[model samples]
Target chain A: MGQEHILKSHDNELARLTDEIVRMGEIAIEQLREAMVALQRRDATSAESVIARDVDIDELERVVSEDVVQLALHGPMARDLREILAALRIASAIERVGDYAANVAKRSVALGFTPPPPQARGLGPLAEIAIEMLEQVLQAYRDRDADVAAAVRARDAELDALYTALFRELLTYMAEDPRMISSSIHLLFVAKNIERIGDHATNIAENIWYVVHGEAPRQERTKLDRTSGG
Target chain B: MGQEHILKSHDNELARLTDEIVRMGEIAIEQLREAMVALQRRDATSAESVIARDVDIDELERVVSEDVVQLALHGPMARDLREILAALRIASAIERVGDYAANVAKRSVALGFTPPPPQARGLGPLAEIAIEMLEQVLQAYRDRDADVAAAVRARDAELDALYTALFRELLTYMAEDPRMISSSIHLLFVAKNIERIGDHATNIAENIWYVVHGEAPRQERTKLDRTSGG
Candidate 1:
């Protein structure tokens, strides 16, 4: 085999890996959005579908790991190595998104028959915001636009503020409406999990920015609060 | 350098990695157990101390990663290489345990001045069991004992059983006494987070067994409930 032939095949491999991860990311984002819709409408069928499809996302994640190992052993040319490593990491984030999607679906079913609590109202806006962020973050990631990715991460502060207010308000609701407490607490957890998914999405955006620009984003972004009771 | 120097240094590096991860895991277990005590006693200072120490665990995690990359690049001798990778994965789990310790402390403060909830009785036993599992699982990991690790994971089923019964009792208490709602929910999240720490410990034990045997352990004694919300 001549040098140019080997080089051409390696470039083709890079293009394939990049395309595959983007496809996987799109599926994850779509499932996350759909999972919320299922919850809002009490659509168990759609929720079940999301749960079933998560295994496919898991399989895709496994394949990406295999590809990375193969690339390392076969030895990517200098220009292609960075792209492969970046895609591998992004695939992991996408896989996590799929897990969260499955989680949301599970919660939707568990709480579906329970009467809606006041805290459920808070989750509506939070979900809307996270879905929007997931959409833009995926686009920014696919474009490798560090500037746009950074902007998406900055948007997380809004979710944090919303979650904080909701936490306090829910605490008050639990105190006032004892009958509604169990369902309300479940809603609190579901909303918190969705917010965490947003955090994970922001983490991926930062990782993409880092992959493009050679440094992780700042440490000052709304980190996990140390006092849950406070 | 002679083959002997190369081999000796490789062995020393592997030992260092293992020792560092073991220390990290032990510290995290201490932090977790202490945070639970702080919560039970309503001792905010102890909780604050646990939160303050989390940064050290975070720093040690970074050092562990760098060591893995160095060993990979420098070509650690064959036996040492496998041990280093196993230690690397275990170190990641240990760092997460540290995060959960901080989480427990934060929940302690969030719980505030409310009289302890009735459902919290379950947490006492769960804590005792988790403390035992943490010690046993870490021992299994360090000693590379598959049987001990398998038994440790088997105990997670009991944790789950305790959690389910605790959650139901908490719900019942809230239904009967609306005033206890907020504190009950706080304890619920704390209980859930501690159970998750047990899950991570089980993961480390499984990895240790894999490192020794070159294959996944046979199916665990039992799996977490897929039907119920975790």
Candidate 2:
């Protein structure tokens, strides 16, 4: 192929790779949403379906990684190389998000067989914020917008606050009614899963920042103050 | 410089890179061990020290990454290229292990002020398994031994079992005494942090397999039977 044709093909391949990553991100979002819905409804079937879908996301991660390795063979320029590297990292983060979703789904399935506890209700809004963060970060990734990515990073603290609140709320329930301990523990774990999903979304945003700026963000992503129980 | 001299320098750089990764793994292991010790002793200072040491691990990751990128600048053959790519991933995993260690230490500080609960003692063995797994996986990476990596993967189930047992034990404690709930919750999170560290070691093992076999493991690393509570 002529050098011009080769360059054009390479560019097209990168674009296709980007498209694949976006698709993977969408599937990840779907997994999170489905897991939330499964928990809200206590639908074991839906939860199992969410669990199964994780394999697909895993396959997509492998595909993205192989494509990255193939692209690396071409010896792309530094900026392009950074994009490729970031894509690989983002794909892994997306896969972990999928795993967290699956873990949430597993808890839902277990919680499904039993009567739903009242504390399970808190998960709805928590999942909402996490899903929103994932959506914003994926969009930032597609547009290569570091501003949007930074905003997503800032928003994670909201999820963390919700998680801490839910943690305390569940503990109170378990304390007041020892009968509630088992189910409350499951709900706590589910909330943790959703909160970690937010963290993974933040991780994706960070990767996007790296892809765009060729470095980490200046401000450290704020961590939740868990110790003070504030 | 002659091509032979250039090749020799490349080999040396790769060796240096491997040495760096091994050192990173050692820091990761130390972090896990120290976090465990801090948890056992309820030493806030040591916990804070573990938190501080994470910066070193993060710096190591950045150094290894920059080296990988620089090494990539020279178009490497496929085997050498895979090694370089795996080194980047392995460093990231090591860094994540450090993060997990720091997280355990964070929870330790929170749990410190309270009277030491009986459940906190369970962490001793859990941390041991995790540290051993990390040590084995790092050795596998150094030797490129897929067999050793696979062995490490199997041993993770022991950690998972211990974690599950601890989960049940702590739940019982909280149920029996409402006053214990808060501390129990922190202990549960500490267990989880260590469990996740095991998972990260498995991740490192998987990377070793990828480096050697140029593909994923034949069987998926069996997830802990969290669903069945086995």
Candidate 3:
């Protein structure tokens, strides 16, 4: 094959590889959203589905990781190397997100027999925002859009605000009515996991910027500048 | 001064530096422990102390980082470089642990009332385990005992077990008493953060062994054995 043709084919292969990892990310988001919806509606069937289908997500994570390793052994070049490394990191985060969702779903199943509260706060909106954040960052990864990735990074604060509100509201409810404590605590955990998913979204956005540009994009700075062993 | 005298003084400086960092680690762990205890006991004084002393932990983290950076720049031998880097990572983790303690203290200050029953069950033991784990790991760091570090790694499972039991127990309490939702939820988060502190201690143990042995000493394996990146 001509050198240019060979290079073009190699890029395609890496793109396809990244696509698989992105699919895993998509499934993780879906599982999370469904888990939240299941809790909001107290739908056992949907919650069970999330629990049962988690194996597929786990398998995808395994396959994607193996593919990245295989590509690493071949001595990938600059862009190719960045693409695979980012995808590998993204998959691990996605799988962990999935595990968190499954934990939420199991809680949903367990709380079914409890004294149902008169009013349960819906987590659907929070889940929607989390999925949107994950989707946008993954799209940025696919297109190598630094601006879009940066926008995703900035959106993390909004997620944190929602999470804080959810916690406070849940607290108010529990304080007013001790009967709602058990299910409410589980719901709180599910919400916390969803918020952490937003953090993983930020991580992905940061990685996307890193892969597209050689430097870490401007971070919303932590006050502690850890100059360890500087 | 004689060359022998200069050499002895330099060794003393190194010893002093190590001792100073360990003392800093102790401060961070104390802050973390007492922050949780203050929340459990509703002692605002202890909690306030944590907020006031966070800057000192941050300052120490910076100093340790500078020392490590200077050592690295001077082109130390491979073993020395490993030890220096390990120390730097430990300093950074300790600083973050202090941040976690400060966060718990803030929550305690805001609470300003008796915690919900679910919180009492969930957070109290978790705080104890995390504080003790930090103590063990810091000892391993000072003693340079790989076996002790390995033992700390193994102790993580106990913390994980406590976390699981506490979470489930909190869930049961919440279900029985919905009024406890808000405080119970906050306590759950505090527990989760403390559980993560346990994980960070494991990380320190892992780094210590890696520094001493030049390879990560494995105990439990993670599923992500992919070829792409470490």
Point out the higher-scoring one by TM-score: 1 or 2.
Answer: 2
Best candidate, TM-score: 2
The TM-score of predicted model 1 comes to: 0.85
Deviation in Å, model 2, residue A127 alpha carbon: 0.7
Error of 3 at B174 (Å): 7.7
User: Tens digit of lDDT per residue, candidate 3, span B6-105?
Assistant: 5566556555666877888799888887887777777788888888899799778766755554443333343554565466667767877887788788
**lDDT of the structure predicted as candidate 3:** 0.71
Worst 10 residues of 3 chain B by lDDT: B221-230
lDDT of 2 by residue, B1-230 (tens): 99888888888888889899999989989988888888888899999999999999998887787777667666466586578668878898899999988888888888877987888888898888999999899889889999999999988888988888898899889988989998898888888888988988988898899889988889866667473321
Cα deviation at B84, candidate 3, in Å, is 19
Q: Which rank order by lDDT, best down to worst?
A: 2, 1, 3
Question: What DockQ does each prediction reach against the true complex?
Answer: 0.40, 0.46, 0.14
> Retained native contacts per candidate, as fractions?
0.49, 0.26, 0.25
Task: Give the CAPRI class of candidate 3.
Answer: incorrect
- Write candidate 1's Cα lDDT for B69-149 as tens digits: 455446534454345546655777788889888888888877747665556667878777777887887788767788898
State the lDDT of candidate 1 residue by residue for A1-230, as single tens digits.
99898888876776677778878888988888888887787788898899899989978976775575455445445433345445655776788788888888887887778755546777778878887888788788767888888888888888877887787787788778776676676667777777777887797787677668766676668654332747
